[model samples]
Target: MARLYHAPLSPFCRKVRLALAEKRIEVQLIEERYWEASPDFLRRNPAAKVPVLQLDGRTMAESSAICEYLDETRADPPLMPKDPTQRLEVRRLVGWFDDKFHSEVTSKLLYERVNKKVTGQGYPDSGNVKAGSKAIKYHLDYMHWLLDHRRWLAGDVMTLADFAAAAHLSSLDYTSDVDWNRSAVVKDWYAKIKSRPAFRSILADQVPGFRPPPHYTDLDF
Candidate 1:
């Protein structure tokens, strides 16, 4: 069995977890506080990041690389499209959520409201929180636009792109930061993805000192 060093709410970790679960790979979940920079954890990933995956007698870092590797090795229920163009689209959307959305929304909201508290950094910065709140509306609207024509974020098929987007949304959803009422299309897309069996572990996650909203685990929600 593989071992995964992860923090439950970290979007990057969640992305890797989802990919692994979707591939039906079993892994031992070892929660790591990367912020402390312990020697063992640092050796696994010198960058000191959550979601260091130990598999096939090798350690792997970076969620995208790990996920792509799993997709190639497992090859069943593929997470990435076969066509080059579609695959590029999937990668583009994955980057969009992990990088752009993370910087604009997650850093401002999750970092302020949850990460800071957990890391003992300080109280939530109201300005950053407010900015995240506002920025999410635009993202939600864009999702609505995408879903209006396509069945999934990148294209017709459910790909790594969906998991990437969901990974970020789930973190915000845990803290009750996402407004599901903002767009029915986006909400419907989320509901479909959230109901998948691969999402079970993510839905079951419990962060210390932080309680998820009641709707967090609701399949119909």
Candidate 2:
């Protein structure tokens, strides 16, 4: 069995967990306080990041790399497309969410509201929270635009791109930061993805000192 060191609400960790669960790979989920950077944890990931995955006799650090490695090795219920063009698009969208969306929205909102408190980093920054709240509207509009044309974020099929976006959105949704009513198409798309069995574990996650909204576990919501 594989083992994962993760923070319960970290989107990157959540993304990797989704991929593993989608592939039906049983894993041990060990919550790690990466901020503390203990010697054992640092040895697992020199970068001191959550989601250090121990699989196939190797320790993996980066979430994207770990997920891709799993997809390549498992090959069942693939998370990436066969076509190079489609794969490129998937990678693009993954980068969009993990990089752009993360910087603009997640780091501001989730990090402020939940992570800071959990890590003993003091109170949430109201300015960052406000900016994150405002920025999510634009991101939701972008998702709406994508879903309106493509069946999924990258193309006609669900790919790692969808997981990447969902990872961020789900984290935000946990904090009730997402306005589901902002776009019918986006909400519907999320509903479809949220209903997947892979999302079950994610929805079941409970963090101390932070409670999810009622709709967080509601698949129909």
Candidate 3:
């Protein structure tokens, strides 16, 4: 079995967790307070990231790298496309969510709204929260545009791209930051992905000071 040091609400951690669960790999989940930057945790990941994975007799850092490694090693249910072009698209979308979307939305919202309280970082910055709330509308529109054409974010088949997007969205959803009514297509796409068996563990997650909205666990939601 693999061991993962992760923060439950971290989108990056969630992305890797989704990939691991989707591949049917059993893993031990150990929550890590990366913000604390303990010496032992620093030894695991010099960057002091929440997701440091121990698998196949090796330690892995970085969510994208870990997820791709899992996909390559366990090719039963493919998370990436076989075609190079399609794979590039998947990677691109993955970067979009993990980088652009994260900076614009996740960091501004989830980090302010939840991470601050959890890590004792002080009160949420109302300006950043307001910006994140505004920025998400644009992102939801973009997702709507993508879903209107492609069956999934990158293409017809669900891939790591979808997981990447879902990871961020799901984290935001946990805080009731996502406006599901922003786009019907985006909502439907989320509903489809949320219904997957791989999503069970994520849905079951319970944060100590936070209670998810009722619809957070509702598959039809």
Model 3 CA lDDT for position 213: 100
TM-score of 1: 0.99
* Stretches of candidate 2 exceeding 4 Å from the true structure: none
Candidate 3 per-residue lDDT, tens place, 137-187, comes to 999999999999999999999999999999999999999999998899999
Model 3 per-residue lDDT at 6: 93
TM-score of 3: 0.98
Where's the lowest-lDDT run of ten residues in candidate 1?
16-25
lDDT of 1 by residue, 86-196 (tens): 999999999999999999999999999889999989899899999999999999998999999999999988999999999999999999999999999999999999998
Least well predicted 10-residue stretch by lDDT in candidate 3 = 67-76
User: Distance from true position, residue 176, model 3, in Å?
Assistant: 0.4
How close to the true structure is residue 108 of candidate 1, measured as C-alpha lDDT?
98
Instruction: Give candidate 2's error at residue 192 in angstroms.
Output: 0.8
What TM-score does each of the candidates earn?
A: 0.99, 0.99, 0.98
**Alpha carbon lDDT at 152, candidate 1:** 95
